[model samples]
Target chain A: MRVVLPAGTTETALIDGISAAGASPELMAHTPSADAEILEYGEPTTAPLTPVSPSGCPTPAAITRAVREVVGFDVTVVDAGLTEPTGAATVDLDIDPGTDVRTPTAVPDADAIYDRAHGFGASLPEDDLLIGETVPGGTTTALGVLTALGEPATVSSSLPENPVERKRRVVDEGLAASDLEAGDCDGAPMEAVRAVGDPVQPTVAGITAGALESGAEVTLAGGTQMVAVAALLRHAGVDAALSIATTSFVADAAGDLETTCERLDCELTVTDPGFDRRDHTAMERYCAGEAKEGVAMGGTLSLVPDGKMAALRDRVETVCSRLGIDADGSPKEETGSNTTE
Target chain B: MRVVLPAGTTETALIDGISAAGASPELMAHTPSADAEILEYGEPTTAPLTPVSPSGCPTPAAITRAVREVVGFDVTVVDAGLTEPTGAATVDLDIDPGTDVRTPTAVPDADAIYDRAHGFGASLPEDDLLIGETVPGGTTTALGVLTALGEPATVSSSLPENPVERKRRVVDEGLAASDLEAGDCDGAPMEAVRAVGDPVQPTVAGITAGALESGAEVTLAGGTQMVAVAALLRHAGVDAALSIATTSFVADAAGDLETTCERLDCELTVTDPGFDRRDHTAMERYCAGEAKEGVAMGGTLSLVPDGKMAALRDRVETVCSRLGIDADGSPKEETGSNTTE
Candidate 1:
């Protein structure tokens, strides 16, 4: 199994309460780089940041790393778009970060990035391909893409209590700026991505198409964002069998993942890591519905055996301690409240 | 077999009669890009240029392409250092092109490029990894690296006459500019690459090291340039077994491939494709030693069966005809003398 994470960023993440993918919106750009480094080296050696929720929950990279420590699978990070350079070695696809979704040009090079990623995907060995994504404010773009493709999308947020009105308003502004209405780009999948989708959408969708061509079983390793990719694939007329894997946090969130998967004729696998039964602060925050799912948290969690959850939690705890985060999902070195409260 | 071509460029290729890897000094920078495109698409679409000898002999990319058309192996181009962009999708390692070897910092980011490529190599499946290179004037850099690593060095040239004195002069000037003697960087391999070697060296060496770490059998797919990579690996205290593959043209060149491989404890395979017996201008140019070995021409040629030479020659003839190169490797559309004469 190969975990391919295409990392990017967007200004939409800067909107307060829209995303909790990083310690703050400014730090979100560094999350993908940190995740890549931690997955490869067990810690971030180059970037001074780590992917964390606003409530201090460790990002899914720690979970994936813990699973890798035991399962010994390979991880490859693709730089779909990055505002900053990553210290970790990545397959640089020569893409730039997405602009604000409210702007006319979100991912200006969406088609080109997709074609390039298609070529990259063809080069991989035909194995089980798990494609995850890391783009701050990705769920908002997911909504933008889905609505443009005529799919009514209800996306999950990293913050609890889902900021429904704010997300709808943001997507509405983005649609107006792009001069697109709901279902305007239903038959033109890449156009939706070009107008309002994040770079990770075309990248993950292209890789999936190419990997399918190479006879690899592909699984989108996120929640609502992956549903958007599936929608793109469906609209593009790709008839390959596809699957989506996500955490139960997302399955339980106020999202349209199941119905959308059904409409696209895609499989859905919801893995529950038993976070509610766990005693760690990050786990508690996850249970509280803050930082539900991002990265490949859901797909990677499926790799852990039921008996191995203890080992995985221990690794997660160790990583949190290293980050100076405590059991209540609060920073030990800095004073902050658990935002989920 | 997976062919990983690390494309790069150097001003050393601009030296007269030193490299026939392109139609002219200006076109040399595009040779790797063209080779990558043609290898992926069976023809060049993005760059108008094609890899060709000054004498109009088709570069090794044609042979590799023909073999790939028949065998259907995967081709991946890596942007080790490119002066120009390629139309084909590439695994961008974010490296820049090398300056002239006479400069002190020909490959300033050698160590970092190597480390990044190492990470990439670990991500690949453990199989027989064929690492080829497309760097014009690479043989000169090979000599610089070999001498710096204290290996008794004789490197081949794409030009028929070998331009021995010019290559030696260039290396001497480079050594002086870097304030180093012939054996000054023996124990410190990457230092030599940084000071005088081209970017492809560190990229290939790093990938080889990383692939070896992942339990893959590796073959350096070129003549003198890949030998330089082997030298780098040995000097860095890599104890893994390795092999080198090249065409009989390089084996018969005025070089010390056999002696060097013996000293380095690496296996060498010399493949002869019967270019002398083929009835074609490009094949004749190859037989006359205008373009000896490059772009893994030797390694890919080894994949053809003994009886498939006719089909291979036909494919070569088709490619040459498409390029408007005639029986004598001169332009079919214009008058020019064969440089080998």
Candidate 2:
């Protein structure tokens, strides 16, 4: 019943969900990278910067080492290298040569990333495992993936004070620039990930693969971003029993969730039941029309045994508290941490 | 659009939601009850109080009189009455007549109250009418209704400082006493409401009736409680297109919402896109299944029209500011108001 928590920026939320479930969680941060910068902007701006190494993706070395160090268990990190560099634009648009006049590039490497992420080998232990993600602009990427797949998607930051319009604009622009056609792409799940997916997709795919390989139960953490990752896993021909742990807000936006679950080949579990009671001012502004991607987080986490749950949660909280991130999981906490800690 | 807002204790939330939508609204208070105590509790107590007269159900006379006093127009208040005085308990338990129970009179005349409050006539200026409700312990009733209906209903107060487990217990106890048997009722859309329906049911039923009579679109302004009311209206043979405005949280918990809508025969709208992003510590703690109800209010107001949205939000904010309801929607505001305002 030992749960291994991969350290990511969203530890605050992930940990809270786990700890509240009364599970024992061990927090291990993936090596910090200059590549990923949790950004806080008063206004949306278009600026070109160095593609920081997608350190946001849990490094295989870190994952393996952490598993051995913290959980004292044998674990393997599947290396799914999608982007040439970690810190690429939130979205990568490529023009396929044989496609129409305006075609977007389906990064073959991105497909490889998904494949490798979802392709865990047979050398893994069989136990209940919770898989989570750490990706930058994940919601934006999720929006890109959903839009590329011809589903309306909205990207909202978990930051309390973030402007809804700005987040929506970023997602819309990314999806538009990707040359995604309006028609439904039933197979667009993988394409969406390949076109604009991040490291977390492969990591989650790997976790799914590992679950399949080890015959273990798995839970994907974070919000819509993780759901998109699960979607990518299903599309990659990996059929496994998987669930998501996310806030209630995502569930509301993603109507007809049973259909979505059927399509994704997974169960939907909404965490933070109280989320349904509080006011989400940004719901209409950003998430209303789109199907929610990540609401299954809590229910998924609940599947984890109590001991592991506590460990994962405790570690997450400790790190987040130490980092001075708002334990509530908003990006606002991260803003202060960027320059300070 | 010009919106008329009836002033009540919790009117602030409704007003803010309206004003935020950039609509002009007129606010008027119900004539204060000569002996109205403005009931205040340091902590939510399980003690049942006499049900207040559904006389608060805007009377036709009162509506017309108020319209004349404020807008100088003729208006009607649908009379939805309570069958009996408030039940001795907060929740209505319906066990087998001979079942051994400690709480002898737990099952209140919930259905009778609903029935009594069932005859508010249609709005005269149908297109101009938007109906809303203000019910104390609504989240508890919402939970009861959902649980009775065989849905996994979870309630959480929006009180930041309150303990999650305590809130959940209150809701759970209230729901259990309601004694909702398995399987849907004869004409009920969902079993939850029938098992423990409240005054709001018949009130909104009449509101829907009134709205249809006048050919005006109606908006049910509350969270899960209103949703349940909408459900009850459909069950009572009301045929009208209705829209629901609520916080994203409620929508999230009520998974399979499309089924709920299909059963209820209405459309659902969500306010607060940022609902998921906000750090709802107390709410989430309750969501861990520690508590069944949370003190949530902000999202309830957004159920109104755009014109009324902001005003309702501002009103809530103003009241909270004055009363200091804490970061979460706790009763701190009430305490401050009692002492000062």
Chain A TM-score of model 2 comes to 0.53
Give the C-alpha lDDT of model 1.
0.79
The window of 10 residues in a row where model 2 chain A has the poorest summed lDDT is A37-46
Where does candidate 2 stray beyond 4 Å? A1-108, A152-156, A161-178, A206-210, A237-239, A248-259, A273-321, A324-341, B1-341
Off by over 4 Å in 1: A21-24, A305-310, A318-341, B1-94, B100-139, B145-166, B169-196, B200-341
lDDT for each residue of candidate 1 in B106-203, tens digit (9 for 90 to 100) = 88889999999897776565388899998888889999999998988888877777788888898999999999999999889999998889999999
Candidate 1: residue B166 lDDT (0-100): 84
Error of 2 at B299 (Å): 58
Top candidate on lDDT is 1
lDDT scores in order: 0.79, 0.36
